[model samples]
Target chain A: MDLIWDGLRKALELLVGLDPEVLGITLLSLKVSGLATLISVVLGMSAAVAVALNEFPGKRLVIALMNTGMGLPPVVVGLFVTVLLWRNGPLGFLGILYTPAAIILAQAVIATPIIAGLGLAALQHLPPELRLQILSLGATRPQLVWLLLREARLPLLAAVMAGFGGVISEVGASIMVGGNLKGSTRVLTTATVMETSRGNFEVAFALSFLLLILAFSVNALLTHLQQSRRPR
Target chain B: MRAPLLEVLELVVHRDRTPVLDIPSLRVGQGEVLALIGPNGAGKSTLLLTLAALLKPAAGTLAYHGEALDTEARRQAYRRRVTMVFQDPLLFDTTVRENIAAGLRLHGVGAEEREQRVAATAAQFGIGGLLDRSARHLSGGEAQRTALARAFALRPELLLLDEPFSALDPPTRGGLLEDLGRILADTGTSALLATHDQAEASRLANRLAVMKGGRILQEGALQQVMNHPEDPFVAVFVGMETLLQCRVATTTEGLLTLALGGHEIIAVGEAEVGDPILVGIRPEHVTLSLHTDKTSSARNQLAGTVTKVIPWGPFHRVELDCGFDLSTWVTPQSLTELALAPGRPVVAAFKATAVHVVRKGHHGGDAAQT
Candidate 1:
């Protein structure tokens, strides 16, 4: 009980004092997760549209794979990204191992399937006749896709939130691929783990609190957009 | 004659390896309104979609203004001159004004022209007050009105309607039909409408095509097709509820006398003596009265007992057992004035012209003159 009280007081002090190291760690966490979410959204939405609207062999298998990927374990993604970026591994020529770019790639791999699965569901929920109606109005194929995306904007925004939340709060992949280097790759999640391991419970609690606030702020903005209007 | 606005030949559309439409030849002429009437699953919607170029037929040729739309590029270009209004309004999740302006925007109309057309079309459909309202918050009637305004704002050369009013209440459907009739006349836009309502087809179409089982059974002028159905299916489908098998007893001038259930009836037809013919009369063309009047101009009048009275909106369908079962339509006012009820005595009168005569075994062709 004494340790918890000490940790809470330190968390409040770190937040109120505008600690530079804490702020730097929080911003890096946001930047890496934010870029990963953006890349995942672009790739995932395109895959979802193709899968949802077109007919081809193995479509069911592909969808099942996406659903499975939505719940992927982050540790496995971290292992694969680490192997790929190793010096003797297949993609080691660029030498970006233990960098923020490595963390971004790993987080993107963990987030893509989530966005893709949700986006496919959102697009499929629309009435089948809507496509015919739009085409009948002289819309080109690309224009039809644009209009349909607009129609599913609310669910798509939810996908963005889910993707961002998935990567920003994950600690396993960030520690493995980001290496937790001080003043370089140290993020809120890794810093919290390090503080706890070093018996500094107060600083660990402060880092955890900062991570929660970061996730909440991003989610609150996305939820505002998702519920902006009734879609019916 | 002006070239047909649309011509379809040897068209076959399939759904999952089953043919849904197998039309051999059909045409919609310039400035004409053609109604395709059929029962449910009769390929009416499939035909409309095919003509709209939204569905590619498995085997067929579609021509617009004498140009063959055989390629994707050609079909896309032809789509600019055509538009369709589906049964369900299917409005976008936006403001009513934006919904109405969508087609014009796709056609590359400038902002000023698009706004002008959208405002004009909205006012024409009495939806001017709802321009700023979100489409998701509209009533069914308002949504349908916005859809129609959207289709018309494009000012396409051809318009296709797929049961546009089937989902509306009768009064709303009637009012919209009236407005659409006037709009079509004023714009002179050729249109093809598919519906299962016989009355709607008769009121809105200059020509009627009766389809069944993915094939066109008959096509001609509305009155001719209604009065002279080529087959038993068509007779019932076109609302000819009363049919009697009669033997011609005599012929004089342009009229023939037929023996129907030991009674003689006169009809305008071309049947020789002792020839068997089928007589059809629409229920609305038959009038009923409490007493028979000899001075009446109707050629056929028979006394009978009212066997059934089915109430339809503002009207009643009275069935009479006058040696033969005859159905007649009468306004509610007349039904009360004549004291129409089961077992009440009544007289059914009809003109010789109302008796549509057709020879047996002559089906799937133009009406044989009578």
Candidate 2:
């Protein structure tokens, strides 16, 4: 109990005073998560709109595949991405293994499915009249795509936030791909794991506290956008 | 007044391999308000959508401005000249001004012109104040008015309305009808509106087309179709509830005695003796009295018991079973004046002019109609 109280006090001190090492880990985590989120959002939204708007053979199978991917374990994603970038794997010439980019790719793989599945659900929730209205209003296919995407901005934002939350808090993918390289690839979750194993409770607690704040802020913003979109 | 601005040729739609709409050649003339009326699931909406060119017909073609409807370019051109206001006022997630400006935006109209047009049309629909307000906040009537203003701003050559007034209040619907009547006349733009309300059709439309089971049962001028509808469905749709098949016997004095259901009653209509006729009258035209009056202008009177009274707004639609089940619409004040109730004997009287003589057997009676 004494040690826990000491760690909490030290964590509060680091937050208030902005300790360099703690701040470094926090910023690096934000960068990796932000990059991963952007990658996931771009790929996810396109896939979601394609599946939601058009019908083709294997459409149901594609949707089922996305549904399965939504629950993919972070460690599994980490292993899969690591192998793709490994020496024996295809396209290993770039040699991006054990780097921040490798970590971003792994986290993005985990986040993509979550963003896509939720995005597809949001698109499905729109009333049929919306499509009919756009068509009847003489909207070209491209114009309609832009219009629908604009209308679904709030949901899409939520999907992005969800993906961000997934990537930022995940430890398994970051540890395997980032290799916990101090000053280079070290992030919040991996740093916390390393500090805790080394009995550095104060550092771990500070990282944990910062991650909590990041997650809370992102979720709150997403919720605010969603509430604003509710029909008056 | 001429061969119509819009003509639909044998437009047919098949849904799940079943024919949902099968409208053979129909036309709407300039400045004419045509009404397509029917009961629920009568393919009224299907026909309207087909006219709007939102759904390609399974077979047949549509023509506007004497040019065949072919190619997306031609269809888009027609769409510029023709527009539809659907049953629900489907507003976008934008301001009322933006919603009204959508059509002009599609044509790449200048921004200043779009604003001016939106303002003018909004004033016309009495929604000028709602311009800056988001469309999601509009009430049903307000949303409908906004949609109308949007469609009107385009000044389309033809307007297809599918139960546009269904969501509006009575006063709003009435005002809209009056405005629509004036606008269509002033612009010389033809309109085809589908509705189930008899009063709506009678007040707004110059011609009425009664549909049933994906086919038009009757189509002609409103009053002519109402008075001498080709089918029982048309008669019922036109508010003719009391239609009795009778054979006119020799007239005694000025009264024409008719045989109905093994009994004889004096019917109010001008018909030749020995002529088999179907006598029909609107419920509102029928008058009920407890006692016969010699001073009444009614040409005929019949005694019947008040069997059922269905209360409508400000009136009661009383059903009388003398020998045939006949309905009479009377004001609530008149119901009290006559002391009418179920199981009470009363005399139903009406003038000969009110009792329209609808010729029967011309189209093989009610069985062959629908």
Candidate 3:
């Protein structure tokens, strides 16, 4: 019981005092995940629009693969990304392994499918007649896509939140690719793992608490965006 | 005569290698409202899509103002010239003003002109007060009105409507229908409206095309098509009508006495004495009895033999050979109770108010069908 209370007190103290190292880790975690989420959103929305609007063979199979990727194990993604960025691996020429860039690449791989799957679902949930109606209104092909995306903005925001939430909390990819180097590639999740492994429970508890606050704040903003569009 | 504003030739639309719509030849004149009437799955929506160039017909050519839309550029231009509204309003997640202005913006109309046109169309659709309201918060009728206002804001050369009122309540549908008819007349915008409701087709359509099983069963002017359905399916679908071409023998008050096949019948409609008029009788409006009673105040009562009985859904269409040949709808129970079959004698009666009277064109009357 003292352990839990001690961890809570330590977490509150660190939060109140705003430790520079913990804050740095938090900002870096946010920066890497935020960039990764932004990349995923662009790639995912285009892929989703293409898949949702067009008719082609193997469509169901493609969607199934995307849905499967949405739940892909983070550790598995980390393993493949680690191999891909290894010194002797196929993509070693760029030499970006064991760095924050490597972590971003891994996180983006983990988040793109999550965003794409949800974005696709969000678009398909719209009335099927909407596309035809838009086209019949003299909308060009690009304008039609733009209008449809605007109509699906709410659900797509939820998709972005889900993607960010997914990567921000994942430790496997960050630890494997980032190496959890202090003051360099260390993020909240990886730092928490390292501090706990090193018996620095107070710092670990503070990192976890801060990570929770960050995730909740981001998600709360996104949820507000998703629902504020509803008719009162 | 000027070429039709739009013409479709030998059109065939396929879904997965199976043809769904096969229209041989259809044309719409300038400022003409052609109502495609049919039951569910009748390919009315498919035809409208093909006409709008949204669905590429497997076979056929679409022409606008007598020029074929042969190239991609031409087809795109044709599409831009037309607009369509759907059964669902499909409003965007925004204010009604934005929804109404969306098409205008896409058309590259300037902000000032777009606002002007949007307000004008909003007033036309009676949605002027709802411009700033969120589209998501609108009732079904209001949503549809906003949708229609949005389509008209573009001032489309041709408007395509696919059962826009099918989802509304009857009174709402009636109200929208009345307003839309007035608007169509006021704007003189040519439209191709697809609906299953006969009353809607009658109220808004100058020409009616009855479609069944992906084929046009009949197409003609409203009264001609309704009173003289070429196909029996159309006759039954149009409420099994019997038409009569007659001269107004005398006018007394709001009623008229008509001379028919060596018989005199009283009816009600606007006509000067001796004017030729076409009388439309819905089979359901006529009733039959084994013997006529003097107490009945029915205007026309003629004793005749049952010429035919066609089984149409629950009610059977009973054709009578009353000096002028008429048809009436009778239930199976009444059919059995009255022992009505071909060659059976009975008295057929209809009130003066039950018939529809339209002034005849110079082309004269079409042959009556049973």
Candidate 4:
């Protein structure tokens, strides 16, 4: 109990003074996760819409693949992305490993399927009358997709939040590909793990507290958006 | 007369391997309004979808301006010229302004022009105030007006409406129908509507096509079909009353005395003495009285037993088994006045002017069925 109280006092002191190390980790996490989510939203939303609206061969298989990918182990994805881009690996020529871009790419890969799956599910839930109404308006295929996406903004936004939460909280891919280099690639989750491993419990507790605050803020904002869009 | 702006030929559709829509041929002139009438699951909606190019026909030809309508590219091009309004209005998650601007944008109307036209249309449809309101928060009538404004903004050459007024109240429907008629006339935009409402059909359509079992059983001028139906289905569909054959015995002051089934009755229609004529009286036109009054405006009066008093709204339909089934509409007040009870003999009365001579055999082989 004394140790915990001492750690809490240290955390409060660090938070009050805007400690550089703690603040730096939080900012970097935000930057990396924000960029990764933007990329995921663009690619995942497009792919999801194509799968949901258009019929094609192997559609069931494709949906099955996405559903399966939703449960992909974080450690396994870390290993896979790391191996492909590490030194002496297939993409070693660009020497991108240990860079922020590497972490962004890995996190985007981890988050894209989540965003896409939710987007597709949201579109499928639309009523048939709504679909017919758009078609009757003489909307072209692209315009129809845009309309459907606008109509499904809530689920799409939820997907983005889920994807952001998934990527920001994940340490395996960030540690493996980002290398957790001090002052360079050390994000909040990785710094938390590193500090805890080194018996720096106060810093770890602070990072954990920050992660909780971030996640809760995002979730709260998402809930507010969803409720605003809901029918009265 | 201008050539038809919309022509559908042999539109046969299959649903779950069963034939659903089999419209052999239908044509709507440049400014004519055609009504497709049928019961539920009668392929009315399917036919409308096919015409709107939303669904492809299994086997048939669709032509606009004598040119074959084929291919998605061609269909989209034709669809831009021809717009379809569904029973339910689809609005996007965005504002009503965006929903109405969808078609205009596709046609490459500039922002200023689009806004101008959309505002004009919104005012026309009485939805100008709802322009900025999100579609997710609109009432049924508001949504319908927004959908119409969107469709009309395209200035479509042909408009297809599928039960557009089915969800609206009577007053709203009447107002919308009047607006639709005026719009079509002003723009010379032809329309093909599919509905089962008789009053709606009679009010809006210049021509009526009776559909049954995936076929157009009868199609022609609405009044002509109503007055002289070729089939019993068409006759009853158009509100044609039952035909009573009577022998004209005498003519007194424009009233003809007819002998019907060994009972003498007065009819108001002109007929030669000794000539057998048909007397038709709508159920609402006939009255029932218990006393054969000394002075009544009614010229035709006959005593008959109230065989059945079926409650129909504020009025009860009194069915008298007078040789054949003679149905008359009488209010509950009259039902009380005559102390009218089933099996009680009462007088069925009507004025000479109320008797109409519906000529026999106008079209089709449906005279016997009616």
DockQ score of each predicted structure, in the order shown: 0.55, 0.28, 0.46, 0.31
List of clashing residue pairs for candidate 4: B230-B366, B268-B352
Q: Which tens-of-lDDT digit does each residue in B81-194 have in candidate 4? A: 888888877666668888788879878899999999999888888888988898878888888888888899998888889999999987788888888787777877888889
lDDT of each: 0.89, 0.82, 0.88, 0.80
In the order shown, the chain A TM-scores of the predictions are 0.94, 0.92, 0.94, 0.92
Clash number for every model?
A: 0, 0, 0, 2
RMSD, each candidate, Å? 3.2, 3.9, 8.0, 5.6
Task: Report the C-alpha lDDT of model 4 over A56-161, residue by residue, as the tens digit.
Answer: 8899999888877776677888899889997789988878899888899899998898888887788888876666666666678887788788788888788888
TM-score of each: 0.93, 0.86, 0.82, 0.80
Model 1, C-alpha of A90: deviation from truth (Å): 3.3
Residue-level lDDT tens digits of model 3 in B1-370: 6779999999999988999999999999888999999889999999998888889899999999999988888887887889999999999989999999998988899999998998999999999998889998999999999999999898888999999999999888899999999988888899999999888899999999999989998999997888666545676577656777777889899898887757877897667887766666787778999999788888888899998899988899888898878888888999999999899999998889766664453223332343
Full ranking by TM-score: 1, 2, 3, 4
Cα lDDT of model 2 by residue, B47-82, tens digit: 887777777788988887667787888886677678
Q: Any residue pairs clashing in model 1, and if so which?
A: none
lDDT accuracy of residue B265 in candidate 4: 70
Tell me how many residue pairs clash in candidate 1: 0
DockQ, computed on Cα atoms, for candidate 2: 0.28
Worst 10 residues of 2 chain B by lDDT: B361-370
Instruction: Give candidate 2 regions above 4 Å deviation.
Output: A1-28, A55-64, A91-94, A213-232, B1-3, B248-258, B262-279, B289-299, B343-345, B351-359, B362-370
Q: Single out the weakest 10-residue window by summed lDDT for candidate 1 chain B.
A: B361-370
Window of ten residues with lowest summed lDDT in model 3 chain B: B361-370
Q: Give the B-chain TM-score of model 2.
A: 0.90
